[model samples]
Target: MKWMQRARVGSTLTLALMVLFLTGCPKRPEVVETVPRAIAPQGEVGMPAPPPAPKGATSGEKSPTEVAAQSPEAKPTPEVGAVPEAKIAEAEARPEIAAEVKALGLALKDIYFDFDQATIREDSKKLLSENIEWLRKNPTVKVTIEGHSDERGSSEYNLALGDRRSRATRDYLIAAGVEANRISSISFGKERPFVLGHDDSAWQWNRRAHFAVSAK
Candidate 1:
């Protein structure tokens, strides 16, 4: 009977040991991959997303630095010795500009007359003829002849003499084939003496017809 009791206790302890071993056994360690996740960028709350780029340029995705940038006023300078297209067009449009520019360089001299007479002096006629020729060559050029006189005569008499001298000068120019309209005459009389003295030399210098030119 004691042996039977010992056998029952052994069986019970063996079953309890088996149950504790099964419960305490460690499970195979799980080794699932743990790759890091990338977080997406957050956009502003109320701002709408940018529209997709156009079909062509967007495809290239070109850098802004790739192409040279130029503002409206940053035009390339013209090459040396090259005329600009705008200036060429202007020259073509205004043909008279050439004549006007040429006229700017032309110069004329004064023609002196006798002290008391309006007749163009013998020496002065030669100069007058040269002036006439210039007027003929530049038909587009107009001339103003200023008749001045000495301080000997009355203001009224000198003014009248001055007018006669200017008229005679105009008539001569007209007869020499210069356009009558192109030659304008004015008189200053003793009021504008060329020399401010009462001597013969001064009077001689003052009794003269002076010329000025302008482009038509």
Candidate 2:
């Protein structure tokens, strides 16, 4: 009975030591969550991002469209109106051109022709030479060499003869260094006469070349 009691005491001591060892071993902590103090959920956490830039206005400097937006008072800027000096000079030269044409028209009087002949007369040749020189001075001046005839010949024949006469004058002017571009020829036949009389003197005057300037 003493031995049994001693054995029971030893078993009791062993159990107590085992329980203490188990209690001293590390253990996972239990999470105890406390109730959070109530407040308005501070809106949303992240800040609002800035808006994207306008299309084509990627450059740091303001584009034309952007500049207008920033300043409401700004008016629409017009494109520069400009003209070159040469064009202005050309515009100013118009009056001088008209004057030159008038001067040339006045310089040439009527030129006479022989009866039934389309040949350019000697005196008329001198006048043509002077006219050609003037035309050379002003290259832009255009002249129409019109051939006329007296009423004695048939209208058809006179027309043909008149054409030949005007062409002869044009050729002579060309030979005298006047550019072909500056001269032209036409035939009036006997339909129009500067002198209405039927006498030889009138016919002589009628069979001739008349000079006139073109309207600008």
Candidate 3:
């Protein structure tokens, strides 16, 4: 009976040893799971985000149309009633031109007269016609007919003859279509002789009507 009891105890000890050999030590318990965290969108956290746009402007900057409309072009200013310097110079030069025309008219030929005669000779008619044409061309010119006489004539008689000769020359111009207002007559008589000689050569040159020119 004691042997049976010892065998049963040995069987129990053996079964305990076998279970220990088959299994190792127990594992540690797993950690608890935390609640899911909210993540930021892209370019957040350690990575830098893009800079914010300036006030009143888009991210890409201002449009070309908006920039052009804000700026305007400047215009040039004009002077009022201002005359050019060149035109002022031209206005100042007009009187000199008129004087030149008057000088040219005086340089033309004079008409001659016969001794003690008031009538214009046929030979003198061509020269008178030329004078008339010149006067016509220079409408603004005025002329004086100065009659002279030979030294042989008496002073009083020479003056009378000179007056008649001046009138004769003036009338011929008037008749040939020269403006009567443009011509005037005077008598120099024997006082202003053209030549100082006693012969006919001197007398012939002294007895003449001379032209003097002026601007109208």
lDDT of candidates 1 onward, in order: 0.79, 0.80, 0.83
For model 1, what is the C-alpha lDDT against the true structure?
0.79
Name the lDDT value of residue 204 in candidate 2. Answer: 82
Error of 1 at 185 (Å): 0.8
Q: Is candidate 1 or candidate 2 better by TM-score?
A: 2
- Residue by residue across 1-216, what tens digits does model 2's lDDT show? 999999999999999999999998999899999998975444456755556667776656787876777897965443445565656777987667777778879976667789989888888878877777777776766778889999997899999988988888889888878778777889999999988997997888899887766632
So what's the TM-score on candidate 2? 0.52
> Model 3, 145-196: lDDT tens per residue?
9889999868999988898999999998999898899889999899999899
lDDT of 1 at 199: 87
**Candidate topping TM-score:** 3
- In model 3, state the lDDT of residue 50: 69
Which regions of candidate 3 fall more than 4 Å away from where they truly are?
1-102
When summed lDDT is taken over every stretch of 10 residues in candidate 2, the lowest stretch is 75-84
Candidate 2 residue pairs in backbone clash: none
Task: Sort all candidates by TM-score, best to worst.
Answer: 3, 2, 1
Strongest candidate by lDDT: 3
